[model samples]
Target: MSFVVAVDGPSGSGKSSTARGVADRLGFAYLDTGAMYRAVTWALLQRGVDTADAAAVAATVGEVRIDSGTDPLAPTIAADGIDVAGPIRSDEVVRHVSPVSAVPQVRTRLVDLQRRVIVGTDAPGIVVEGRDIGTVVATDAPLKVFLVADPQARAERRAAEEGGSDTAATAASLQRRDRIDSTRAASPLAKADDAVEIDSTHLSLDEVIGRIVSLVEERR
Candidate 1:
């Protein structure tokens, strides 16, 4: 039986860590849907596609081939057989991902690919994390979690992860991403009605992971 655990949250909300932790504890494969978008964004930028032009992005979508690894401990993303795992996470790609991902066609193509990845998994199940996994990609998932944190807390966490990057700048960037992701036309970031909401503003990573693990166990 496929026991999918869908995790959704805004940037810096600990979606990736908590989801990976849960998948590791349960021995399920992990999928970071956001990386798929980042990979496509990286490819578009590499090809000099104008990210602001939705039509141009949509037209170029098929030209990029994105493949993601499902291991929670070593999740990977490659574009067209090139190991772009490092390049896709650059600040430039981060800035352009929102615009490229906002394109309806891009979302459609990626969503379908995401589903295929989950279905092809041979593990007990999969834990999929993204802004819209619960709301759009896996609405029928047996377990869904929506993680949130105080904006300040999220900013601090993200800054620390980025090698003590500017807290103020990171906070502003995260809030900006939240606005764009939440307002986008295609598969906007949202919490599913059936999902359990976890405010990690004060909770440690283990605490958040534990809470979701209990939920998964109960649902299973």
Candidate 2:
């Protein structure tokens, strides 16, 4: 069986960068499940679909084709045959992603696609990261990491990533997303019972990546 590592955490918790680093070091495929949601949300907004309407969002989700590249060194995501790696990161898409992801139909569709990607990976293993990877997408993954950081740290990191956007506003947005993700009826953001929780509040990026790589080695 292919070894799988599931890294789950809320926004700005270093899930994406850390997971990508681990995958690069281990020669494993990397899947950013969050980007999948963003791709769908981007498509919805581009098509003028009302994200707030559950039925409309669900109906439109199936019509959009989302593709994720598994290469850790240069991961890519596209929606409806258009390159959307940059577009999905726009402020508009970010604002709607959580709500679009909350729709059960959207989750059901993307979760199936994610599983197919995991099973079909040509690498010896895969590092998958997102809010519910441990609890929902890859429950049977051999290594599950619940990465976390204090709100202040997370906000600072995110602000820096966004070209030094307002830290206070970023923190508030992260808090709002936390509430929505944790309370969503469909696979909520949560740590799996057996997951290893790692607090990245005070850890450097290299340090955090090294720890997770070490954990993966221990599992192997």
Q: Give me the candidate number with maximum lDDT.
A: 2
Candidate 1, which segments miss by more than 4 Å at Cα?
Answer: none
Give the alpha carbon lDDT tens digit for every residue of 1-220 in model 1. Answer: 5899999999999988999999999999999999999999999998999999999999999999999999999988999999888998789999999999999999999999999998999999899999889888988999988999999999999998888999999999998999999999999999999999999998999999999989988888
Pairs that collide, model 1? none
lDDT value for model 1: 0.93
**Each model's C-alpha lDDT?**
0.93, 0.95
Error of 1 at 96 (Å): 0.5
After the best TM-score superposition of candidate 1, give how far the Cα of residue 178 lies from its true spot, in angstroms. Answer: 0.7
The list of candidate 2 runs beyond 4 A from truth reads none
The TM-score obtained by model 1 is: 0.98
Q: What is the lDDT of residue 192 in candidate 1?
A: 95
Task: Give the Cα RMSD of candidate 1.
Answer: 0.7
Question: 1-220 in candidate 2: lDDT tens per residue?
Answer: 6789999999999999999999999999999999999999999999999999999999889999999999999999999999999999899999999889999999999999999999999999999999888899999999999999999999999999999999999999999999999999999999999999999999998999999999999989
